[model samples]
Target: MASCIQIEGLLQSYIDEEASVSERLLIEEHLKSCGACSERLALNRATAATLFEVWREDQLREDLTRRVMAHLPEMPPPTSVSAALRRQVVVEGQRTRRWLGAAARLMPVFTPVILIILAGLLWVAWPSYYNMGGDEVIGMVTYCDANPDATHYSQGQARRLHVRNPIMPDDHFETGEEERLMLSLAGPSHITLLGQAAVQVRAPRAIVVTRGDVFFDVFRDNRRFQVHTPDGTITALGTSFQVSASKAGTVVTVVKGEVLVDNETSFVRLHENAQTAFTATERPTVRQGIDTSPYLRTARAVRPDPDAERRFLTQFIRNATHTPAPTEQVFVVNTERRHVNALLLKWMPDPYTSGHAGYTVYVSDSAMAPVFKTTISPEIFQDKQNNMVRLEMPNDMRRHDTHVLHITVMSDQSSGPVETTFTEVAAIGEAS
Candidate 1:
């Protein structure tokens, strides 16, 4: 016999129709057998029913009255002023409006001064603050324990992007909706998927798929190696690869690397020389006889459009390869001279072949490596003529080097992953 306190815990489950059959039966049996419990349940149900009935009636009456009132003419607020005073008030209001308009125009001139003063005040009030010294900021100034000592690119010129995990159990996820999943990885690494996808931290760094397909582009210094799906699992030994998983099972074709497919019936190892397919109830099968060239051809045909793919691909390549163009620049010069207020990296045609196109942006230091990254939701793509991103320095963030940016642009349906990179340059005063 559960105590009343314990029974109360099940109340919400009961109301939500989520209680197990055994729990429901136990509750019903207890209500029938125990007089006090029965009375309490009856009273609670009756009260709920009564409240619902009353609320329904009240809402209905209010809606009817609102409809009736909507048909009636609206009356203006009553005023007691004499005709002369009313006319005077109107003239004074017009004069006030004109003054307000003049002040609004002058506000822009004063805004810069106010901002400078505030910055001065912050410096004066907190003079001891300086750039935080850590391996992240010092870059080659410190020892490279896990990374290479050789120069991958110029640290000062490249934009560093940090991409964080986008799918946590605490994160809001809707089923059947295409979501752009961004993750942080050392070096130039990215993952993008269509439909429902969730990432888990343990055991080969897994991402469980609720529905749809996913694509991963992994680079150097990354340890993550496995992707789990409903039909089968794809485990990477090393190198670059692309895999598509659905209800029909998983089709794994290596671009430049090797992977192991573990189906329930058999285990098959796929190397750079071969492609493999696996299903839930069947054994892993290798296709050694098929020509790899045709597969690549069909893949290109099924792949998202070249223009849509270039958006994300360009961002990553931009970060990975930063030989200053002889006569061209990617970012436009800032007119306001404010701290790089916003960085927008966009791609088009919904980033996919079957559905609408889209683009996403990330902020980091190493365009090739990102510590934290995510997609820009409610993003405006393709129509941005001017830089519209606004970033607040020190308040919104403190300027630090060794930070990296990785952007991944994805399509709506039947598309693949396109990744990009941008590096944040220290503002004029912060460049030491």
Candidate 2:
């Protein structure tokens, strides 16, 4: 015979049908004599049954609501409430009763027809609603180590890949020891993956680095390219950069061009030959002259065509300097001490410009009084293809102040000086 406390412990298991046969028999025998235990078991069963009944009723109500909504006809707005009230008391009441009775009689027949119509509508609209298109092959594996074990995830399934495998968006890659992989992507971007690295192609313009080191030789384009690390996100401004991740922090190295490194609290811009480090809980630290010789060697070996760079630059310039400059372009000036306050100015040359001489940037106070000026050399824009220049604020003038920049571009074919004025506002806040 089982004691009441023992039977109490086994009661739930017995009710759930998980008790051993001997234990079940023992509990059954005890329940026959123990009123309290028997009542508890009965109460538990009754509660469960009531809950199931309520759930079933709720589900039925939901189905009926959906069907009723589908069958409802559109109604026009009421006109002349006094007239409507008089009509509703007489002719409308009879019509309403007849319609309700007829609807009740036809519900069974209408259900299947309504379901079929809905299914057809869903079938017709499914693709556009979900945007389920074939995955884009953005890149192909150019190199792999001997029998290197790399896996790619697609459509919620993981598959192993060999050399020459096509990389698609949302395709995650995990490499093993002694493994080296190279990817040639659409932007003429060359990515080199070292061993023990994990990365995902989040989109055509974005890559997420989970661990290890990867080098990027991103060809300059108008697209916003980003690399997300655990510590921060690095945004490319037409640059070749490298991201290295570890348990301690993530390191970003800019070999050429520029990049913006941002964490939750602050952001810092890195130029050529610059580097920065970020940790999840700490502010980003800028470092001087990182050694990128090893990655630079790899980038040079797989360098893209010189013409591609020129085309990208030309397209960017055309887009940035369209006919009749837009009046609403706003450039925010950063007041954070760690960030460089600069404005990027670009312009298109006249139709017959053979060569550009240079540019002169003049900074003036709010009253239009000249405060600072500098002349930029044509060599700065040479081979870049893009007629763009950056006007940086002198260190002394970077304090909380409003300034105006007057830019004049000199080219051989220009009939007159090409000039534009920009307002720079120093907003007070931490850099984002």
**Per-candidate TM-score against the hidden true structure:** 0.30, 0.40
Q: So what's the TM-score on candidate 2?
A: 0.40
Can you write out model 2's per-residue Cα lDDT over 305-381, one digit (the tens) per residue? 33433332232233333322322333333333433355566542111121234445555555556546666665443
- Each candidate: what lDDT? 0.45, 0.63
Root mean square deviation (Cα) for candidate 1: 36.4
lDDT (C-alpha) at residue 349 in model 1: 15
Q: Which ten residues in a row have the lowest lDDT in candidate 1?
A: 137-146
Where does model 1 exceed 4 Å of error? 1-184, 194-204, 220-224, 289-432
What TM value does model 1 have? 0.30
Model 1 lDDT tens row, 1-432 = 877666666755665578999889777766666677666666677877788888986574444786787799878867899889999999999999999999999999999999999999987875121232321211111111112222112223221211211112212212134333333222333344433433332221454543444445454234656777666777775444556666777777765456777867778878764777777878877876445443333222233333433433433333434312222113332323233333444221112232122233334444444323334333332222221333333334333443333333333211223222222322233433
Winning model by TM-score:
2
- Which residue runs of candidate 2 sit more than 4 Å off their true CA positions? 1-135, 146-150, 298-432
Report the error of model 2 at residue 95, Å. Answer: 91
